[model samples]
Target: MRTSALREQRHPTLTPAAIGRAATLALHDELSLTPKPGLVTLIDRGSHDDMDAHTFMRSLFSLRRYFVQIAEAGLAGAEFDVLERFGIAAEARMRAATGGINTHRGAIFMLGLLCAAAGAVLREQDEAPRPADLQRALRRRWGDALAQRSQRTSTLPGGIAARRHGLRSASEEAALAFPVLFEAALPALSTALARGLTPQQARLDALFHIMAVLEDSNLAHRGGLAGLRFAQRTAQAFLDRGGVARPGGLQEAHAIAGEFVARRLSPGGAADTLAAACWITRVCGGS
Candidate 1:
């Protein structure tokens, strides 16, 4: 058995502020990752015409306090309704920071909940929780509430597109506790890392995995069902070609990025999930 000091050294006490900073840095890391098909990055504006990396950064800065507040709420055992109110205020702040552009809106919801879950888990444990533990905590604490929330129709573009295309809305994804993030993105990232891939390569692979499976309403909204199907097929093809494990995989991913841009298809929801995966990795001390 490990000594108390050693365990403490391994799992430092996670404060709400630290958790919030981790969430923000995870978003930054995702934005810094290159060649994400139909997503914004530091080098290219994938498929979005309204925002870039700088815009994402500004939104991240604006939402820092929101994450901290929600994390604190989780530590205090606040209800989901209260957390939703915080999220609503944060969304308004994000739009204000981005000049009415919807940068980081999806992230603010998903990552915000994840942050809160982390706080709740840490509060109940002597040591820091693992990624799986945090995920379980999220579902155990908020699954029922999330399901109830998902029952209501969404008025956002992604929700509207999902309804029209018969795809899962963002709320539905949350209600199911983000199976794509946990089952697809997280596992893909962990596998890539175990295979000795670089952080960037692993994250890229994870993003593609999410794109392959997630019915990203952003893609539906932008390119319609046809666009969503095309994006899914393209992502699946990349994974079949050995993802980041194969030789020339990075080049192929960049090529796909160009294609997605030409088609004006942006899988923003998948991109957000990729960031959430990164956040989980970091929170679980996998990074």
Candidate 2:
């Protein structure tokens, strides 16, 4: 376990501040992982030109306080509108920080909810927040609100594109308690680590697993439904070929990255999901 994680486990009284910090760390962990197909990293901007690592950093910093505040709200049993208000304020700060770029928008929603859920779980149990605990807490506290959210028409490009392509929007995924995050992403990460893959390699595994199945609105928006399918097939093929563990795995991954760049494909939703998985791992003390 990480030293900080150990400290968290040793001390059962985890606070909103600590939960907030974990969210930030998880986002950074996702950001720092390089060679992500069509995604930005500290070393490379795989597919995006509007924003890079610097832009992402500014957005990440801008939302640090938002996570803490939301966690506090969750712990205090604040209503869904209260959480939405926090998210709206955070999004404004993110836009301001990145000069109106949409960096971390997906993350702001996904991780924001998870952080609040973790807070709610802590309030109920005052114990360590497990992945299941957080997931259940999110659904129990905000399932109805999220269900209503899913039915609303989205003016966002991703949501519009998803509706056009007959794909699932992120809000829809949230309404279902994030089956992919809990069932697909987290399990893949755990399985990869169990197989002795390096943490970086494990994350790559998790990201691809998410892409293989997620009807990513970002992918649909950028590349249309065809693009979404193409990305999914490519990701599935890579995993079937043994992922980043095989001898030529890195080369194949780079090749996939090249393809995404050429196709202007950015699996932004998958990237966000990967970040959420990282958050779960860190906060839940998963290997």
Score each candidate by Cα lDDT. Answer: 0.90, 0.91
Q: Write the per-residue lDDT of candidate 2 for residues 46-123, one digit (tens) a residue.
A: 888888899999999999999999999999999999999999999999999999999988988999999899889987
Which whole-number lDDT from 0 to 100 does residue 62 have in model 1?
98
CA RMSD of each candidate after superposition: 1.4, 2.8
Residue 74 C-alpha lDDT in model 1: 88
lDDT, candidate 1, 104-174, per-residue tens: 88998999999899889877985677877877888999999999999898899999999998999999999
Each candidate structure's count of clashing pairs:
0, 0
**Backbone clashes in model 1:** 0
As a whole number from 0 to 100, the lDDT of residue 118 in candidate 2 is: 87
TM-score, every prediction: 0.97, 0.96
Model 2 alpha-carbon miss at residue 85, Å: 0.2
